[model samples]
Target: MSVWDDLVGQGPVVEQLSSAAEGTSGLAHAWLFTGPPGSGRVTAARSFAAALQCEETPRGCGHCASCHQVLQGTHADVAVVRPQGLSFGVGEARELVLSSASRPTGGRWQIVLFEEAERATERAANALLKAIEEPAPQTIWLLCTPSPEDLLVTIRSRCRQVMLRTPPTAAISEFLVQRDGVDRETAEVVARASQGHISRARSLATDAEEWRRRGAVVEIPRRLTGVASAVVAAEKLYQAVKAEAKARTTELDEAETSELRHALGENAKGRMPRGTVGALKDLEKRQKSRATRSERDAFDRRLLDLASYYRDVLRLQLGAGNDLFNVDLEPELRTAARNGRPEDTVRRLNAIMQCRERVAANVHPQIAFESLTLALRTG
Candidate 1:
């Protein structure tokens, strides 16, 4: 029912954050909040920022105008920057530094939130460090990343770190029932299935399209019977993942490219500039890198889904319980696990990880994924 409740079952994190809200630790100007995706890193940052800005007693009055604006992203003091295409380059970092250096208009703290600080390039990280080292008197810098290893040690050394843990299934299920109005049966199922990924739990509780997509992916392992089938599955994954990556990055890339092209004027379009060729090549390189990262991220999500299906199969093979992600596909799980060994399940998981490593290393995605499908199909 409140912003804090949106974060699944992080009672310990909530308690620590609440203490921080009450002016504990002298209110350090910099904080790094790190966790897995869907673990409410940004959500925690926003709530903490709102609590910082609230004038009401005990802070974080969700009903206050300040909290309203802060939550809605219209507040003057709190600024959140989610990287557009891929990397947060020096230009973006400089803008963030400038915003943080300015006086807060609302007479509270100026909070700059970096969502996915792991995506910041080395140059951008240095730019951010300069601002953090000698910050504005009233400014607060909050960085959210998947892990501290993703950030420069120099930058992290200056900030207080808040580590987030995935909540237990019981707490997660209770959270959904009390705060989201979800029924107990559905809530418990989603809680267990999501493995404490709060946002994913919520989506699984409500979304049908997601189930269909995951269903298609889980079914592919069993359907790979021939070279043609394997190739088609590989292409299906590539096209699906590539389309998603393109959908996310294309508009942003075009806008940035247009801006650069416009700034150079009509003479620079086809005519020679001393550095034009190099810049073009550099741009292409970064774009390709970003595309690969996005595709891998998407594929990883699917792999996790496949792993979950296998997990359910493991439980079923042991007669643990009736828990199933694809309630409609339970018979399929029964059929598949019926023949698969515990070692076979392990081999499949390892194959998925090996495929991920290949993709991360910039292997040709089509070949890598195709090999993965074939290996898991018959290995």
Candidate 2:
């Protein structure tokens, strides 16, 4: 796809990035691209970098050698750091900065783009700050995070920030249909379900299992009819979450465990340094926290999926007509709409929000989710 095509509903962002790529105002070196999860921050940054690297006679001609390489993330001068673990550690930041120090081989700029800088630890951010302050003449730094508040004030102040807004649903829908050759119906559902997140929209559209999982989540509100149902739902939900947590935690635990082993091989006979042991424990704690967060996020996405279904029910109750996003739930939605009042719909929305809040406040997922089922049952 072309550079601008991936930007979806973000006209303002596309225009600004296109202008910068066209060499307007001489292109700032340190740019901070921030937006909601689905906003095209990383996509925009890559597009801008591609345009800059393009050796096309017109430059930024998306089809040119330089542009293609940069877009494919193979450009020698472009370094993108995405987190493997939960946070970008100081070690990773140091490596990026070291790479950023080298000059571009082409006559253009050496670029480093941090895709999720909010994930960077404070010490890592400091290391990034040093590189930004003393950037090589031809080197440019692009830091992308969710918000200005995510980065340190010093880092935020130094960089030129470009904020991306939520793309309109129609824009996203039209984009998917036009560029991806996806049917209009599927595109519409994916776009609406994605809630302005392009990556998630793409996944929802292309992945069959994701759609199936969403269907499972939407069906939960109906099936939670009694105490036994609640308990069973709670058990199932806990197992789902626990399954995910175990998968994520295992990989992370293994990697850290390996790192620890490598750092202190079996050859060591003396006791480990107190500081080293402390550092290892801290890493373990952080890993566990991250695994917990990952599982929670997965659970939240499912809740949001269910919320979308209730919203559809509300839509039907309001006589909003047929093109509901959840095709499988048309029957239940129609039934709920006919039997439920507007107040009932509102109450359901509140229930969903409360469940979200409870989850965020560290209430056990099973309890919060089961309680949500009860509220939703009445509504």
Candidate 3:
């Protein structure tokens, strides 16, 4: 297998990056990779970085020492920066810029990969822009985000753009079965349900808990029969998202706290050192920000799941030929389509989208989900 093997359904992107890794003239010092969520932008960027360091003839033979080191994140010349909170601040951007000024130690290039460049603050973007504008001869920058428009115009203009498409459902299904050992039926179900999100498909295919959560989300329409039930369902959804976020972050949060205390010598005396209180406060603030973002992300995923279910209902009502995303819930979907007017389904979808916008605008999840469920109920 080559480094490109894991980049599912991105043949054109693989070809372009491979040629560049082979010393093509079109290669630039900075590159911006844009794609939808779970479209593997980060994976593609990492693969390209590994290929640049590969010592093998085809440039990305995954068996080579350099490739292994790069993939494992132990390469001296390669660095990856991923934001832990809601945004990447100027301090972190400056640190990365300072690091990028160094020349390559072992590989042909010194590479810096930034995941989610869209989350960079204005000052952070300016800091990155300076680095990109005056990069070292051997330095290369790879930034990943959902779209070029999410970045500042100045920063994006200085970088070569690489666009990635969402992989087809069939491609995702095949990848899940072949790579993850997921059975074909489950693979197909997950592929359609995930709407081309590769990571989500893998989770739904491999994890029963994920499937149950999704089932709960999609079944909301059936449960929202009265005001009391809608409120109850809304509260349950909010709690579910909070619980998911806590489960995901609890271990990492504790580890980070322990590391900070050890670094500050708190473990030696069971008390914080002088001036360490401020540092601890900063850490807690960042963790809280990260927790909030994680909960919102979980809630968004639930909203998307709910949207896809209604979309299936709409398609069934219209007699559309496209495959339903909620194929496993066909009986429930058929009942929904039979009972609800097509106009009502459209209203329900609009309400769901509006709820997403509201949540993004900092509205409380309970209020947003309550309104959404009530709209779904009335529809």
Top candidate on lDDT is 3
Candidate order by lDDT, decreasing, is 3, 2, 1
Residue 70 CA displacement from its true place in model 1, Å:
1.4
Encode model 3's per-residue lDDT on 111-229: one tens digit a residue.
99999989999999998898999899999999999999999999899998889999988999999989999989989989999988999998998889999999999888888879999
Over 4 Å off, model 1: 175-180, 244-294, 314-331
Q: In what order do the candidates fall by TM-score, top score first?
A: 3, 1, 2
Residues 110-136 of candidate 1 have per-residue lDDT tens digits of 899888888899999999998898899
Model 1 clashing-pair count? 0
Clash total of candidate 3: 0
Which residue pairs collide, candidate 1? Answer: none
Stretches > 4 Å off in candidate 3:
267-269
What lDDT score goes with residue 15 in model 2? 76
Winner by TM-score = 3
TM-score on alpha carbons, each prediction? 0.82, 0.79, 0.97
Model 2 vs truth, CA RMSD: 4.7
